[model samples]
Target: MPIPSRAALVEHLVRTRIAGDVATPRDNNLSHYRKLANGDRHYWLGLELGDRWTDEQDVLAVMAERCGVSDDPEHRAGQDTIDPELTVAALDRLAARLRKAAAGKERVLFATGHPGGLLDAHRRTADALRAAGCEIVAIPGGLIADEGMVFQVGGVAVLERGATLWHTHSPVPMAAILDGLARDGSPLPDLVVADHGWAGCAAQRGFDTVGYADSNDPALFIGEAEGTLQVTVPLDDHVFDPRFYEPMTDYLLDAAGLPV
Candidate 1:
């Protein structure tokens, strides 16, 4: 069975319910609202974009149209993209528009297709929302590079230096902590540290595979034989809170018990 797209689902919901005057394309410019038959205020997420290749807006518009809310413009109603760069541009534009619409709205949440990638994009989006005076909560990414390293190394003779190297050029895009086992030409990992995406982890898990979140948790440091390890690396809780970074020269110096 084929699953219906978001637009289809929203269109069905709108058509079955909602009875009110919908703003026309021009009136939908901004600050458009509809009073439902039950006196509920329903704001449209994509009211201005009558017909556009926006997944979120198209879904919201379809909902309005189905509920007799009016989409007389016959806007483009589906996702169509041949160019990856263009798609990313479109996404940025859509995010800007949605953030603008979120102004003065209570509890507006922006949903994205690529959440992990969205973490990378949060700086701009979060700033826009803050400027708009909207209450926004951008959840932290599930994992980071260093926390992932501790999880990968487990407890393989904690080097006094606490330095690790990542093999970024390998066929697989993963960070490799050079433990004694890796240097000793051992074929099997003490435990597979699946810090990459689900597919990436699945492919690398010829040995026991642990998910990224599972490995990063500080409570599960059972040891290499147990296929479990965890560590709490201090993270800066500024704008991008909980984002882990490699210990700086000063941090390393401090960790080495040397006065800066």
Candidate 2:
């Protein structure tokens, strides 16, 4: 895979509509921030946030700095953005962690709540890390959580129910993974690469966790702020085409010095 230049990645992000005036509008973004501030556990994404992020303005500030959203509370209805530079910068941080995992030959678990959009990216990263001597943590079968069965497809953990892969924001699946590993005397992951509840729960439990988040999801960013999460990259979690993530993933792997 060719490594995309910084300029090229930025262009891809804006042109592909993954960032820069994205699909998630400002009003929806503010709504989520408000709910998160009001102590909605659903917005907590599986972490026990307590009162660390109860201020709507505080959450908006983090999103603006880390996610490139507008900080103005008055700007409630127009377009929002995921700054391409911040996205690339956060990807650099994520790559640093993966590079260390590879160098240490560490046990790394990769999971995704965003199967439709991020599955390929996770798979590509996992495959690269495995090739570089990291152990891709196994997703144990028969594991169920959050009313959905936990399963692995193409080496990435995801939630499934009713014979369909379900999109989830619950951390129960990660808990099940850890519990299952303990029961079998298997080693816990040295690092967890995931998003949604998977990343939140792992980080809460003190694991080295890194993952991605969209503009509306502020828990991972809060976790980073609170010193629990390693790093969380910001992007639109879902683009209409899964293939849209290829360039970003390629850039990430390249930055991590891992061969595809």
lDDT of 2 by residue, 6-80 (tens): 999999999887888799989899999999999999899878889878889999998998899988888989898
The regions of model 2 sitting more than 4 angstroms off are none
**TM-scores of the candidates in the order shown:** 0.20, 0.98
Relative to the true structure, candidate 1 reaches a TM of 0.20
Top candidate, metric lDDT: 2
Give the C-alpha lDDT of model 2.
0.91
Shift in Å, residue 33, candidate 2: 0.8
Worst 10 residues of 1 by lDDT: 213-222
